[model samples]
Target chain A: MASSYSIILAILAAAAAGLVGAFALMKRTILAGDVMSHIAIPGLGLALLFAWDPLVGGGLTLFLGILIIWQLQKKTELSAEAAIGVIFASSVALGALLIHSDEALVDALFGGFKNLTPAEFAFGAGASILIIVALWLLRNKLIISLFSPELAISSGINVDRINLWYLLLFGLAILANLRFLGALLVGSLIIIPAAVSRQLTHSLGTFLTTSVIVSVLSMLIGTFIAMHYNLDTGATVVVTAAAFFVLSLFKKKR
Target chain B: MQPALTVLNIEVSFDGKNVLEDVSMELGAGESLAVIGPNGAGKTVFLRALLGMIPYRGTITWAPKTRIGYVPQKIDADRHLPVNFKNLFAAKASILKLPAADIEEVIEIVGLNNNIITTSVGHLSGGEFQRGLIAFALLGKPSVLIFDEPTASIDVAGEEQIYDLIHRLQDAQGITTIVVSHDLSFVYQYATKVLCLNRAGVCFGEPDIALTPEALEKLYGPHKYFHYFNDSHSDDHRTKNHDIQQ
Candidate 1:
């Protein structure tokens, strides 16, 4: 059995990753986050290729993903959605090719959840706290930017700077959650909670608060279920979060 | 005191077709200017250009430090989207960081009660939505307010209320107001200046001097049915005046 400290550490890591994902979804930039998550795959392959840690590889991969997406969005005629789609498809293909040639595909796909060292836990927890605090301080500006960027500009809010910060924080969150949730499900964790919360509240503050609560609860419950049933933790967490989303929809309908 | 706004050598074209050319006009502050012309006379384009929503090649400058507010001819907001007055007001204030009380003050000035604050904009009658737009524009306490055919989709009663609201806002705030309208009778009652436009701006002055029959004939030509109707109405009044004098 995993130590009590380890379980707590895992829950904390999941919550942090979930919160970052939630923030991205709230801002309606989930496509960007999804692209960054996929780009981490090639990084995982390269990390395994060099006998380096996958988390480090994943972080570097996610950073490159962000750079490609940002540059394409600014420079290309393609809309933000199309840019993300192109990057996402290409990154996934490249990652698949790298995995086929260098590392066992199962290892990359299942991720390194069983090998969560105490050091990685600490790193994830620290990164998550930093991202959450940054989002909190800029919540007001972020909401305004999301709703109407032109109005935000006239009001003296530097929208470009805020979008840059959001991208940076999103990259870091995807990087931190790579080991615990794998790169594939990390995007879902970010999107599902916030989307569920959106149906429950109209106020921005309420939506964010409820998103955090739902994320934390899903992590804890999913972790417990995984432990009892001896199931894969990452899959179990996402499934549980999905369950919560479905529950929110029903409750909202009532 | 040099007219509130000056538009000189303004030219706007869409896809190589000229919408307006060499359109020029000057309006004074605390004065009401009514722009009247047939359809496709670039009335909406002129208003949008003033708001900086479209790109135009010419010099159009307002009086120094003039805060300008605009109400579009129509807001094509999606009916499916659940937008309400509070949501709309909050969306704007979410940028300015203005307190709730400030939003409420503008809503009250527009004569919209608390019911409008919570009701969905999709469900509001055209009159209510127009008032909401006016309230949204006025929330900034602009020095100049421009309305582009605000009463186009509303009933006569709604138009009267809108006109009254416009006058009320002008009187209360001393704002320089410009309205683009086809309602000549309404303009006669409220406007201090008139700007007549076609593919090019034709005249800009007091309505009595600017809206001469000759000028109307030149701008509208065969489309002077409404102008003649107004002329006959005025002739009847003149005849009655002569009879009274006798």
Candidate 2:
């Protein structure tokens, strides 16, 4: 019964992470998250190598990802998307090379859902709550900056400052959830829920709210199904989210 | 009295090529100015430079630190962008951090009905979209308003309505206005000053004094439209009378 409870806790953690990811996707720029996830892998490998928690390594990875993107945006001709792509591909290759000899690869790639504890569940919930609060506080500036940056600037909004905060929040969200979803599928988690919700509603507020709800529900369903059927938790969760996206698309078409 | 805006020796270039060369103009508070030019004459570029959207090589000083509102030529709304009037209003409210009531006031002033505010901005007719943009611009109670061919996509009646709105806003708020347009007939009534621009800084001011037959011939250069210049003089006379009554 305790094992079953742990499984439930793991699903909740995954869902909270998924919700953060969804917010990133709704902003229409999740390439940055992708880069952070890749950079996180090497950090994870190094953490395991040094006998440290992988989440600590993931946090360092997320920070590096944001810093690198910010530096490239300032000094290079390459856009944020291009910079993220370069970082994402290179970091993934580096992580594969670094973790080749360790057993960490199995745990990192498939995720060890069995190892989730109540403390981790609390951490995940706390991170999710923090992300949501930050987004709420900056919602107006973020939405305006997204739609028409020039208009926002003209209206006396400091556009550069807003953009900096936006990138920072994006990095933190990816850092908080890198363990459950893995680097490969973290971006999909953020993008799929928002995209699916967008298909369901025309209102931006409704779309955002529905995305969060969908993310949590999918996590619960996916985790339960994974345990019952002896399936991989990460893959099951992603597949469940994808299935919901497909369903929403078909419903819109009708 | 201080002029609402003063542009002194403003020069604009794109990719090492000059678009607006050494242009200077001023508009007094409550005055209307029309920036008239042919296609590819850099009118839009000039307007953008004044708005400080583009980097330029001169000083644009405004009296009393006026809030300048802008309406761009085209607002592209793709399916990916779920922009409605509420989204636009929310964007303004967010940027300005204004109360909801202020946003509604601006919406009402722009004459947008409740039904239009709820509809998607992408699905709006040309006239409706233009009005929505005007509403958006007027939200902060701007003292200087710039419209970049607001009537270009709309019907004739729509164009007249837009001009009427412009006149009403100017009269009500005493705001300085600059309109960039190729359509001379629409602007003839409202423009206190007309600026005719071509490459190499060819311009004339004071609509009646500047739009001469010879000047029109020189600017247009062997076009069929030169004959229309003669008719424009008589139309200008009628327009002057219309402006007096308004």
Candidate 3:
């Protein structure tokens, strides 16, 4: 039996993921974002080992991963995908070695929908709202910067600073959903909905809106299916989102 | 009156290798300056330095209140991107906190119609896309227009139209123009001054006076100079001098 609070939080997080995913897809960083989530695995494993709050540990390492990726790109002049790929492989290995218990590892890898306490709901919902609002405010800058960094620089926008902000917000979005979606599949929610929406829409506004709709639909449907069949919520939600993407491929892009 | 721009002994390097060295030039207000060079001659790098997009050693100065509008050579945009010209214009306008009327004015100036503005950027033709970029640069009413090969992607006929449009914009607005061009004819037609670069300032002055046969030969290796002029003009001797004022 899923609590209404848990469902509400999940829905809000889905909307946030949808918005973030739209920008990620447009920036061609969707795959990089998937790998970015893996950096949180080692943190989750450490928290389990030490009996600390798992989300707190995940948040710290995710923040470190974000900074490392940003600095790697800046210093090495490597593309974001390449920089993230380097960090992702090491973080996954470290996480695998740290988590000694199989059951805890499964719980960390494929998240379950547990009853949400008021504090957890408040924190998760607050993070979701923060991501959504920050993205909305930064959308115009992000649009121009992603289109052309040279043009954005000439237009008086601080492109590097904007990129850093985007990376931070992207990490926050992942952290907000890490408890429910887990590291393995959380990035899929952020990648698949926007992909589906991209196939269907041809304008920025439509693309963002449709992505949010698809993400929310996936969350709701996946939750129901999970509760009914006693299946994993995170895996089911990601699969549902992937299903939407496959169906969207059938619609001829105009 | 003060000069519109001045670059003094500018030097840019990457990985300890100097891409541009001892490059210097000046442009007066309402003047059109053409930067000519062979491939990898640091022409684009010079433009980036001028725009303050990259760091360089020497001083590059623009007069106070000098707002620059830049049209880059090419945009490697994703073809399936959902953004249209209108969306890009609106985004720039919003970032600059400009009024909607400003967008309409630029659209009219660049001769972009509603259909073109509504179409996705990747879908627009080469000429239409170039016009859209020019229109984007026109926003915020910049005092200087900097173009990096404005017609690189355009066809032969479209190149002429783009040049004419740039020439017209200069005449109508009296804005300072700095263009990096490969077309010798364009330099003679529109530029008030020309700076020939080959890792350094090889020559700087009016087209006919500074671009001597010897200078052209030095800037573009002798073989390339002969081939370029011979392919375009009828006589080799006349091509050497290239009396473009005709």
Candidate 4:
């Protein structure tokens, strides 16, 4: 069950990381994604206490965080980053207070994928697959919105509605990846793969393809390494992604 | 014929700082209107208000079933964005449901090489990039086209070529064009009507009469030079030049 869950997670993580990651990176919402995941830590702690699926808690909390950030920024003139900063500070302070137990803290931060039940596995698989398909189907409009929002509006795309929908899906994708990448590093898993792929290709198709391939390969390799050496799963996976980013930064001869 | 677009009592304020105030204009079908202003004179604000992109207290009435094609002041894109003409064309085809023949016609009209469709947008030269963007806007098959600083990056010869192409396109297709530019020379050559936009609407009328020294002084705070068509012919001939006096 454990290995099967890891396999499912690795596959879904690849697709979600590549697809959602591209949107996150392009929209300049990488920081917001990272900060939202961090804000989910306390939710995970509460979920553990209640013996609930931690992803549920994390997803709910992340959604709430998005609303708080959006409203605060909308009602006031606070920049999105500044709004996220304020919420993030309060979130971390609350997370630190709630996550008193060491095991819960480790699980929240490092993500233990070794004990996922069949039900949890199915939930993760379902959510991740849904996100992947949604992204694939919405690529054209999403690309338009990301590239030139004014064009999107002029072309009759509801830019605001699309933005809100994308944000909600981002929260869900982060939740789905929380099994292995953990709340602390899930956003990085998404960002690193897409960032590396961006440096490699000049065509959108090639960029997306490279992102997915690199992410899948990294997840599988990191899983193997963690299993063999008894290392931290989340940290090892993120390190593998970072390695890909480093490799992509090398200049090829013109 | 009734004007294709009408703006009444238009005003835009950002954080209580007035960007545009009590501005109004009427654009007729098949007419080319140039919006000329100095930098920071709310020309962009005026354009965005027309596009319905910003909040403004105004009534912008468009003729029934008027489809507008918009080209923004600047395309906010990163140097590394993975965009090729083919991809952009494909996206346009999907969104606008344009036929292949119509799309190819637009590509030809914009004077872009058919073979350049495979090249990435970032790699295209400044002139080529402008042509490509114009091609993209043409895909909408709009009755009206709005351009913001379309010649900002092009060289002098490239600018002439673009304005010539625009004039030819307008003549061929009878599309209403609203252009925002600081190039008084090009605007004078191409514009049938002109509006000098400042915080408050400075002046609006035919190009020859609207671009008078008084309006120029008010909009630009005493310009060095300006040229207009000689009053004898009432035609677009850039032969006459004059200096603004205090």
Candidate 5:
């Protein structure tokens, strides 16, 4: 059975994921975000080894990874996927090497249903709210940059700084859910809902709203089903989101 | 005709290889300058350099308070993207803190209707998309407009319309226009000055004077098209390639 705090944190995280995913899908960075989630694995491993707070450790490495990827993208002019590729492989390998226990490894890969303490819940909720608010404020700039970076620059918007802020927000979104969805499955929560929303809508305003709604619904229903069936919560959530995507395919967008 | 832009011996290089070297040009206020060259002739590079999108080793002076609006050759917009021109315009408007009236004004100036602007970008026709880009560039009341191949993807008839729109915008708004174009006829007709580029400044002056057969051959290499410009042109060849002759 899931605790109330876990459910609340999961819902908040899902909302953030939905918002982030909408932009990531448009920016064509959804897949890169998947790989970005894995960058946290090494940090989780180090935390587990040192008996440190896993979220903190994961966040440190996730942000470091984001900064490195941002710099690589700026300096090397590689696409986000190419830059994420440079970091993804090594991070996963290091994580695998450091995480000695198989159970710990499994938990890190596909999250464990651990009851959250009041502090953990607070931290998670704060991060989720920050992601939502920041993305809301940045949405207009994000839209322009995703549409055309050159146009954004010509508009006097700093494309690089906006990109950095987005990447950081993307990292923050991943970090907030790293405990709930794990490194392997969390990206799907972000990607699938937005994808489903895209399939159903043809306008930005509705697309964003639909994605958040689908994401929250998936999290709530997935939690209920997982608790009832005694199934893995993260997997159940992802599978639920995937089911939405499958259904969206039937309603062909005009 | 006070100079709106003055460039002196600009050079741009990437990875130790020079893409543009010793290129120079000048543009008077309200002048339509056409930049023409064969593919990979640093035409886009020159534009980027002027726009300050890339670092260059020269002085480029734009008259103070000169705002530039750019229309790129193409944007590989994702088909599934749920953004329309309205969303895009709103986004830009919000970013620049421009009033909504400015958006309405640009939409009217570009002749884009509410229906077309509201349609998803992926669903828009090539002409519609081009018009949307023009409207986008027209935002913020830019004093200068730079276009990279404004009609590269449009059909022939659409191309003519796009050229007409650009020419009209220039004339009506008195916006200093710098266009990278492949259509020599449009260049000859509309360009107040022409810059023929090929990794260097091959020629620069009025289109009729600077765009001689010798100058064009130097810029694009020897082609049968150059024969059309020669005073001793053959009627047979002109009839054969009437489009190029034009």
Candidate 6:
């Protein structure tokens, strides 16, 4: 029953991450996920330090990380990826310094699902639904902004404001998924499923729907196999997502 | 009646270096103006200043609430992104807050076939892609249309056809047209007035009076001017293309 609760949380987190992942993949910011995931490790360390829930700790820490990256990118001459790289390296060192024990490091990297509670499961469901609905409402504007910034400006859309909001949504999805997927595997959860969907679909609508379906399936299969074989669930989910991406590559697109 | 657009002593500097200086012109309603110059001639900077995409020290006064449509020379699209004609048009239509028209109507306005809207933007032929851009510009229904090197990356025949289409569209709508072009042949054939620009306004008048051998020499310098003029260099097809028809 406890494992089932954790599984549900995993599914919700995967769904949220994979949905936004579709757009990020198109924007060529797929590596930003890897960067964010590594940086959120320090957030996990802070959660243990404060005796609060890891989700709260990680989300707040990653939020600060996002802000730093955004401001540095704007105020300095550094590129966006370069700004993220600086934060990622600093956070990794900080996370290492803060972690007390081998078990704590393992939990930070791979999430101790055994520690999850019923309340955490509920929180996962609510946050996932909220993120998905928000993305749905903003879909049209996001699509337009992603296509052409000049067209966005000419049509009266404030492109900069939309991009900031997009970054917020991206950071939120990444932090929320860091629980079950862990800081290491969460980035793959977002990228691989969306990438597989990209190869199979022609239109934007199909692209989004297919990515969600693939995310859910990968989580279900990976969790079941890992539970049965007594393997690391986080690693299994990532491997499962990779398997899907491989199958997708074989399927001819265009 | 007051002119459609008036400029007085336009100056643009980047990092304290002058890119364009003391440019002035007055364009009447429905008049077509072509801005011609060689590389580093500040043609794009001038166009950007006119579009209000950049800043300059100048008084650029337009008639009140004048709507303008701009078609860029080209857009580089990523093949990984999902961009089609209908969605692209829908984005602009939503911005305009106008009801979306049938694909056929838009294609007809821009002289394209109905089936092309579903194709990815990167896959379209050069001419068809340019028409697609013009169709998007028309979504705003502006009184003035600006083209930035419309015939670039197109074959000679394709360039001629595109210019011909522009002429027909301008006349039919009585649209005020402004084109930035390097093709002197097209300027001679279609421009009502020309502005020869190189860091400053070299000359501004009807093509016949402004584009004389002296002005050509001044724009291109003596060595390059000899090939363009003096009837010695037969290899210049644009000039030969002009001669063959005359």
TM-score of each: 0.74, 0.84, 0.95, 0.91, 0.93, 0.87
Candidate with best lDDT: 3
Candidate 6 residue-wise lDDT, B170-213, digit = tens: 88888888998877777778888899888999889899999887
DockQ of 3: 0.70
**What is candidate 3's lDDT per residue for A1-254, written digit by digit as tens?**
78888989999999999999999998877776888889889999889988988888888898888887766656535565565777888888899899999888887888888967787789889999999999999988899887788889999999889878988888888887887888998999899999999899998899999999999999999989988999999999999899998999899987
TM-score of chain B of 5: 0.90
Q: What value does the lDDT take at residue A181 in candidate 4?
A: 78
| Interface DockQ per candidate | 0.13, 0.32, 0.70, 0.56, 0.70, 0.32
Candidate with the greatest TM-score versus the true structure: 3
What docking tier does model 2 reach? acceptable
Candidate 4: what's its TM-score on chain B? 0.89
Summarize candidate 1's per-residue lDDT along B1-246 as a digit string, tens digits. Answer: 577898888999988999998888777789888887777899988887887666899999988888777776654443322336676677667656678888989988888987866765556777887888788777667899889887776766777899999987777788989898877886788899888889788877888888877778877786574664465233222222011010
The residue-level lDDT of candidate 2 at B189 comes to: 78
Cα deviation of B121, candidate 2, in Å: 2.4
For lDDT, candidate 3 versus 5, the one ahead is: 3
- Candidate 2, which segments miss by more than 4 Å at Cα? A1-27, A31-36, A49-52, A67-84, A114-123, B94-99, B197-200, B212-246
Model 3 clashing residue pairs (backbone): none
> Model 1, clash count?
2
Give one digit per residue, the lDDT tens place, for model 2 in B1-246. 888888888888877998888788777888888887666888888887877778999888889768988876655334344457777777777667678888888877778888887765555667787888788888878998888876766766776788889888888888788898766665567888777777544665777777776666565675634554334333222222111110
What is candidate 1's CA lDDT for residue A61?
Answer: 77
lDDT of 5 by residue, A57-86 (tens): 898899888887777666635565566786
lDDT of 3 at B122: 74
Please list the residue runs of candidate 4 whose C-alpha ends up more than 4 Å from where it truly belongs after superposition.
A69-78, A251-254, B223-246
| lDDT at B139, model 4 | 83
Off by over 4 Å in 1: A1-33, A46-83, A100-127, A130-169, A252-254, B12-21, B33-48, B53-55, B70-101, B113-115, B118-133, B146-159, B178-246
Residue-pair clashes per prediction, in order, are 2, 2, 0, 0, 0, 0
Relative to the true structure, how large is the alpha-carbon lDDT of every model?
A: 0.73, 0.69, 0.86, 0.77, 0.86, 0.76
